[model samples]
Structures are given as C-alpha cells and as structure tokens.
Target: MKRTIRLAASIAGLAGTIVLAGPPTTIINFDTYPDGSAVQPTDAFTTQYSTVGVEFNGPGPSGNSCSISPPNHAYAKRIVASFVDPCTGVASVTSYAGTAQDSCWVPGEGIDMFAYDRDGNQIGHEFNAGGGHFTAFSFPQPVIARLDMYCILQGIDNLAFIAPVPVLRGDLNCDGAVTSSDVGPFVLALIDPSGYAGAFPSCDIRHADMNCDRRVDGLDIQGYIDAIFPP
Candidate 1:
C-alpha cells in the first residue's frame, strides 16, 4: 500500500486573519529521516526559508528561480495541495512564487502563504499577486504557517512583491458577494443560546467572524455591513 505522509501547518490565527508567524523559524533540510525512516515516496523537502518566511523555493537558485505569477486565480485565494507518500515529517518542500510578470501592473505586489497539511499533500496557498484567504483546510500533522518571501530587488527592474490582503470577513456567506445572508450564522448564534455547545453558536467561524477578530460579537456583526458595503 502507498503510505501517506500527512504534511500540514499549524495556524497562528483562525478564520479571516493572517496568523502571526515569527521567531523560532524553521527550515527543512535533510537527506534522511530524523528517525531513520526509509526515504519517502517523494523528493526531500528542504529550504532556507526561515520561520519568518513560508513559501518554498522553486526549481532553481535563490538569485533566479521561476515561480507562480500573479493574476491567476491562485493569487486571489485559491488553495494548492500536493502529496508526500512516506508519512515522514516535512522539513520543507519545493515550490516558488512571483517569478513572472507577463501582465505586470502593480510591480512587487505578490505574496505566498503556506498553510497546514492533511493527507498526502503540503496543503496551503500561493498568493501570486496579493493576499486572500485560507479556507477548508484540515490538518493531520503539526504544521507551521509561513509568509513566503524574498529579498528586495535592488535595480529598476528590481521588484518586491506586495503581500495579499486577507479576504474580507463579511463575505462570510461566501456567496460570491457579501450580503445580509452573510449575517445569518451569527444572528442564529446571537439570538439563540440553547442550541449550541461550541464557543460560538454557529460553530463555523467563517460565518461568524465578520471582523475576522477570531471571535464573534456585536463588533463582528457591525463588521459585516461595513465590509460588504464599506464606507
């Protein structure tokens, strides 16, 4: 049977927010398993990316490597999942970001944030142009979220990608547009108490964390309208 290495990330925050990723940074580098486990069904995952950074390098050297470019849906909040078969821990994996600019407009406006792992894949996102959201992720192993980064380009042709802005919370309903329906979950929780045992009555944060504060409250309810139809 093909064994499954469940690569994943541990988030610093929940729903609609960028989790704090700093200090105690980790870079995966290994030719063998720390436990002497046989090499996995995949290539070794290693990198120089510190805890301060998350996205792994692409198929080349630091000074020059190709990566996913912006304007693609991936840049706007899409998830990328890849599989690793050995079930061995992930020190790092390979992938790159913001290397192309065919439709370059806002130069230096790109970001890549790696999220948790689940079954056989390094599950996360590649914010090619700017920020978006991490959604529908499930973790099977301890994972670290990283802010994929790179050095500041020093020439006129040089560029530093601008990170993505997390998706607005009021779009909680995720109906392709924010609306009153987005407020339904929070209202149910706020208006009814006897139906839930979870911290928030709605249980699903994406629905209630309107302010993306990691909590549900009147402020979030207020956050809803403000974001859907902001001033």
Candidate 2:
C-alpha cells in the first residue's frame, strides 16, 4: 500500500513566510519480491528500485552476499539478510542523491545502524540489542544519504523513508522559498554553476531557471525579479 504524508514546512520568501507540504513517504516491505530473492550486486538492485530513489548495498568490503528471506517475525512479511558470518557482515541502503529522511526498519537480529549525510558525515546511529522489533532513526534534517547496518545476524524488513521535497522554482538557496535571498545564488548559478553548488551543497542550481526555459541564463533575471516583487 502507498501512503502520502504531508509535512508543513515554513518557507520564508520576499512575500513572507508560507507553509509548504513535503513530499510523499515511501515504504518498502519486500513483499513484491518472491521469497528467497537475491539482493546482491548493488548496481542491479539499485536499478530495480530507481523509481523509488533508493539503493541497497551489502556484505561490506569482504564481498559476502545478501538475500531476501521468508517471514520470521511479527514486524514484517519478508526480510533481507546479510549474515555470511556472525557480526562480520554489513549492509547499506542509500537514497538517490542523498534526498531521503526519517529512515526506519525492523530487524531480525541485533544490529548497529549508522546514518550518514550527503557529505559522508555520521548524522545518527542506533543499536538494537535484540531483534523482532521496530526501530526508527532520525537525523537533524532530511539530508540522509545512506544507512549502514552491521549485524551479528541480520534480517531487515519494512524499510521506510520520507522522500525529498520538490525544489521550489527560483529558490536557489533551497530554503523552500523564492525570495531576495536567492538573488546572489541565482547569479552564481548562471555565471559559475560549480561555485553555486559549492556555496549551497544541498541545493540544486537548476532552481535558478526562473523563466523555466530549461536553462539558467540572463533571460531568467526578469522572472526572478518578478518572483521577488510580484505585481
């Protein structure tokens, strides 16, 4: 079943602050896959879930294996496991472009989960002493790029995450609003795309396309000015 969660975020613009709804939430229960399905070869697995914007990687640097298993707990209908040896395996789930938030999972064994941001900084961590329960991990913002699970015996199910919010046009600063604050970044995006990116790592410079002609050029100046000072 698909679920849509609406989170109101305050967006401050030249017009003032306004409430904007967040993007939908995606839940992967692994029920669609047949029992005992292989989840290895990270690239292939990622392509399968490309529409949902997530990737699964596993077995750590040792190059073990991971697979889907039949239900063994009350928390999930199916689970993914990476237990080549006791406490010697690692599995990871990464959101495309580092745009996922509020990741949760159900574990079948004791596991240590670590959450990282887009820049590879550790943002959150959780350790479940035992299995067969629901565990949720949250970070300071919706910038979670990856999640790693180190396990003694791993079985994960019912993985869920909040998708990234859509970029507001002309909101080059990525503050969820189009305002005067975006002018500087917008200029940078047109003159030096890489510089704009470095200045606002989490932002997509394409948002500077105020005229919406699919290009960030001088033509967008008027449109951006209009957004800041609408008639």
Candidate 3:
C-alpha cells in the first residue's frame, strides 16, 4: 500500500522536482558462472575480438585455463582473471608486446600471458607471480561490452567482472537516459515480469518498481510518470 499526499498548488508545483536516480552501479562478478569451462566462447567475443591463440611450449606438460559466465555475453567495465600456476604455485602477469609468447617466459620456463583488444591488437599482458593471483584491466572507456580472454595457466577459478555504478532506473532500454521509450517496456513488465525479463535479460527488474513497494502496479506506473514529468 502507498500513502497519498495532497498538497496546495504551491507545494504541488515542487512535485515534478522529485527525481529518482538510476540503479546503483554494481560489479559483474564472473564467479557467477560455473567453473571447468571457458566462458562458453561467446560469439559476441569471437566476432569482436581475436582469440590471441595462447601457446604453451614448456616441457612439463603445459596447458591453459580460463572461465567466464553469463556464458554468451559480458557487459562490464573490466574483466578479472584469477589463477594458480602449478609449476611455481604463483602467478605471473605482464603487458603483451606483439610477441609470439609472453616475453616473461624463457626457454622451457615460466608462464606467458597475452591480452588483446577488439582489433586483435595487444593491449595488455600480465602473469601471476604467486598465491591466489588477481589482476584487472579496464576497457578503453567505461562501456557495457564483451571482451574475450585466454590464458595458458595451471588453474583458473572464480572468474569475475566489474560493472560500473548507478544504473538509470526506468531506462529499461538502457540507452543511458529515461524517456517515453521506457513506457512500453515498463507497462509490459508491470503486466508480465517473466515476459519482460525475457525481452530484456540484462535489465534489473527491481529498478522498475519505482515505488519501492516490491510490486509493479498502476501506482508504480503513476510514480514513474511523476518521476519523468515532475512538478
């Protein structure tokens, strides 16, 4: 239930001044995805980025490990990789320099890492040096897009991503702004949450419940309109 407030013209004029902020920026932790696989090799990643083709030429039965979640696409400011190297029980990370392999690796020694941008250009490279290694790199700018990664490591686990802050509530289209464009989706969600979710999988449905009543109804719709129109 919601309480109704009636005010004189002077006070009502300020009603439209009420503004609701967008959703809080949050991190997109890849750990949400299960382990033992490489982020399902998304087409979005494959189409946008070149799989740098990590190669391991060590004598000690070398291999690589990588895992990411949401299985198909990633919308994050940056991706984080965590790993443990069996050979040294440590991790090594470095910037990639267009070399066939990470220069960090010597003749039959250590691990090499290579990171690439969407244009198949080497952007960064790093290797783990020791226990519970973690490193992150940001995109050219803050964006919601997919970035593919490959690693020739011993163990990979708990991969996560970082989502920027403050989601714009009512911007169901996620176009960075709220307008009439959101009305259709908002109505659809108010009537059918599942259907709406299916249509906009990336949208946080909670943001639609503008009244904070935990329910989507006519009142919420009116509240959304008020937030948009404002006194």
Q: Judged by TM-score, which candidate is best?
A: 2
Distance from true position, residue 167, model 2, in Å?
5.3
**CA lDDT of each prediction against the hidden true structure:** 0.33, 0.49, 0.40
TM-score of each: 0.28, 0.41, 0.34
Candidate 1 per-residue lDDT over residues 59-168, each given as its tens digit: 12221122222112112122222222111112223222222222323546543434442233445554344222111222333342322332222101111122222333
Stretches of candidate 2 off by over 4 Å are 1-25, 30-109, 116-124, 129-132, 138-146, 164-169, 173-177, 180-192, 195-231
Candidate 3 shows a clash count of 28
Between candidates 2 and 3, which one is better according to lDDT? 2
Question: What is the full ranking by lDDT, best candidate first?
Answer: 2, 3, 1
lDDT tens digits, residues 72-156, model 2?
2112122122111011111223332211111223444455666676567876767654434445555445556666655545445
Candidate with more favorable, higher lDDT: 1 or 3: 3
lDDT of 1: 0.33
Summarize candidate 3's per-residue lDDT along 115-215 as a digit string, tens digits: 55434565555553333344444444433222233434323322233322233566666576888888888888888889988999877565676765445
